[model samples]
Target chain A: MNDTPHIQLKGVKKRFGSKLVLDGVDLTIRRGESVVIIGGSGTGKSVTLKCVLGILRADEGSIHVAGEDVTRASGSKRDAYLRKFGMLFQGGALFDSLSIWENVAFGLIQGRGLPRKQARETAIEKLAMVGLSADIANLSPAELSGGMQKRVGLARAIAANPEILFFDEPTTGLDPIMADVINKLIASTVRDLGVTAVSITHDMVSARRISSRIAMLYKGRIIWDGPTDSIDNSGNPYVDQFIRGSAEGPIRMEVRS
Target chain B: MSANENILSSNWNIFAAIGRVVLAFLAGTGRLAVFAGIAISHIVRPPIYWQLVLHQMLRIGYFSLPVVGLTAFFTGAVLCLQIYIGGNRYGAEAFVPQIVVLGITRELGPVIAGLMMAGRVSAAIAAEIGTMRVTEQIDALTTLATNPFKYLVVPRIVAAVVTLPILVAVADSIGVFGGYIVGTRSLGFNGAVYINNTMNFVTAGDVRSGLIKASVFGFIIALMGCYSGFHSKGGAQGVGAATTQAVVSASILILAANYLMTSFFFSE
Candidate 1:
């Protein structure tokens, strides 16, 4: 409800060897704002998310969440800070060794220190919310189909009811129908939770379905940012080229034979 | 004019090659040592996963029994045969049982079992963890408020250290029995005398030394496996490389550690 920035990245820079991934990335998201970052395959959209999460430290500048500098926290303070976030990795990233219910309940039991029985109950409830039945709870993650695994990943991410949620390519590697289904679930989940949501995805349809605002990351900087509905008339050539899905534009594709 | 320069450059190239190789080896060693230190620091921390430790013990120790038993048996049989042939030259064939028991307990039992585990348990560990790494399961753990080192690494190290000594103890018995079988059945010696000679010649000190070495070898095997898996990158190929590295490094460390421990125990 508060209109202050919940997360802010000021001149954040990240470099992997000589390849500069995020070059002076500056972005701000207000509390409870659902923002989707879109870019080409290697434009460092994921790097920006990771920087805010403090998974990958920014080489230059600072990242602050809820007015607290991310890098300043350590030990239990850092742990407490991380507890506020729930992430859905692009790969689903479920623990293969654990049962599906256990995977869903992982953050609850491990992060929040919820008892296993309580966590399992929460896990089953969350799975049902994602339209998965409770019987599949005992099955291994590998047993589930790709779409089912993504649902399970969503269930796991929201099971802890984190204050902030991150979806990394939520609909990637799915059939169009399954991707649409996942988009609906993610849309409802974000609205229901009322959490600040940050997503990295190239799927414009999914982005439009889930995000309140859209930001285009190009060559490491946010070249365009506006309301989700206003993306079409943004006037930025890169944004126009990206939305139109055209190859013949300023954004050159390096085609390697 | 350029011939002298070419020869000098070639000479410099040889030294550079050696320097690079040596530096790579040192860097690898340093990384393993740092990983071991981090693992050790977690051991004293709270939230020790005893169930995971028990599970690893079953995997690393119980499942390795068959291969270790078979290897120990063959090794002891060969030792008896070789000792008999060598002793015959010096007219000391009667001492075969004593030397066989001594050798099995003090040297071969721990080293052989350690090598077997290096191939079996170490490779399995690296493959499993390396796959987890590539899949983001490890990063997922970080997000879920679990320490990967505490949850994944410490249990394995503990399981190995606790279980390996027990395995070597089993190996020593099977190995000595193997020597007994060959000495009495094939080498034309009385069974009772063979058992008596083995029991009289082998001391508690000999078995103790082997057990200590087994514990050290266990530490090395688990450390190498965990180290390789934790740092693995890429995908399936990375996991494969990690598995190979784990086995090779664990095997080499086991042998090197065996020699060092043997000398330390017996140097006086």
Candidate 2:
């Protein structure tokens, strides 16, 4: 394994109009590590992920992936940069107009121009990898349940065999049992693929299960970052408040503002 | 601090307000023009989704024909009756066939069909693309290495530009037939004479001009639709707002462009 970090962000700042969403977020992750970013609602967690992916550019920062600067990359450079990433969107974000297998095979056929037949076969294989059966291949995304949709989304993410994977609130809005199922699948996928994984979620149970290392984002900065086992004994008030799911302490919930 | 200075300041405020409004309008026009330029450029570029373009043609062009035809037919019939009513005072009722055919072929066919297609197709594009935008499907497309402008935008634009002229051609025939029906049946005119006058007076110049207007109107409709939807935010209300704006802007631009084109084509 290379000792250098696979991804690095330095002094990233992002603002939406007058509101400063990400003040100055800096984080780094080595190759083949699953880093889950835990944060409260409206804490700019998704924005951080988006900035890293170049979906939303940072106002001030430097982001490097595999030693290549991609802060303002566009055109073919951006496309090539994106080819290394596979994202499972918070809402699955599956193309509603396409069928299940077609949704899974979308990046392949549309982006890579692979033959539909070959793409469908790989799509089904990916679906099976995510514990989905072959029967649901013909069904539309809307026909599937929320959990099933997320599984399909995961299948799509891994279909291309990307070196990096991003999960935006992967287990959000799922029952505990189903969430656990997804969490286990994600853990195994990251382990087996040996790919770097970055996820954002408020679900501590999920964050704890899926990540080897955990980073807590507060006010657009990583406030607490450590190995998953040490999260409880981190001795930080914010970390304690967040992990315990408490509304008290130094962490204040903005209610009725 | 002084009375004269206060009055001057208040007057300056009005001037500033006017300047701000004008500047905003100019900025908006510039942005829309740039978006349209990019969409046009994308049309001639590689990686054009020909399949999606054909699909959009069916949706925007073929699906919109019935409404366009129905509106044109009624517009032509009404124009004939109105012209007959007005021409009766001047003893020019015999000119109804020539006037109706010319009006339908040159103005009402393209304008009415353009407006109808704007309402039907522009709103649909805005709603569909707006939903995709709000749902992060557009971002997903980016992550998947697909260009949203090419996949979601260019197809609708190409389909609209290519199909609207064909639609207007068909609508022109239907509108003339409508005038013929009302003229021969309702206005007590001889069928053979009405057909003869209509055929003789309607030149290729008139029909070609209208088809040209239809193509221009098509570009406006798709541009407004794609532009509004591409920038849509704030979820359901945003999508709703975009759909409304697409239809309104497309309709207004169609009419405005019709005036400009008409002046250019017939100012002589």
Q: Which parts of model 2 have CA positions greater than 4 angstroms off?
A: B1-27
Error of 2 at A175 (Å): 1.2
The C-alpha TM-scores of every prediction are: 0.95, 0.96
Question: Residues B92-200, candidate 1, lDDT per residue (tens digit)?
Answer: 9999999998899999999999999999989999999999998988888877877789789999999999999999999999998898889889999999888888898
TM-score of chain B of each: 0.96, 0.96
With a 3 Å backbone cut-off (N, CA, C), the pairs that clash in candidate 2 are: none
Worst 10 residues of 2 chain B by lDDT: B60-69
Two-chain complex of model 1, DockQ on C-alpha atoms against the true structure: 0.78
Model 1 ranges off by over 4 Å: A1-4, B2-20
* Model 2 per-residue lDDT tens digits across residues B1-268: 6999999999999999999999989998999989988887888888899999999999988888788889888888999999999999999999999999889888899999998998898999999999998989999999998988899999999899999999999999989888888998999999999999999888999999999999999899998999999889898999999999999999999888999999999999
DockQ of every predicted complex: 0.78, 0.84
Where is the poorest 10-residue window by lDDT in model 1 chain A? A71-80
Q: What DockQ would you assign to candidate 2?
A: 0.84
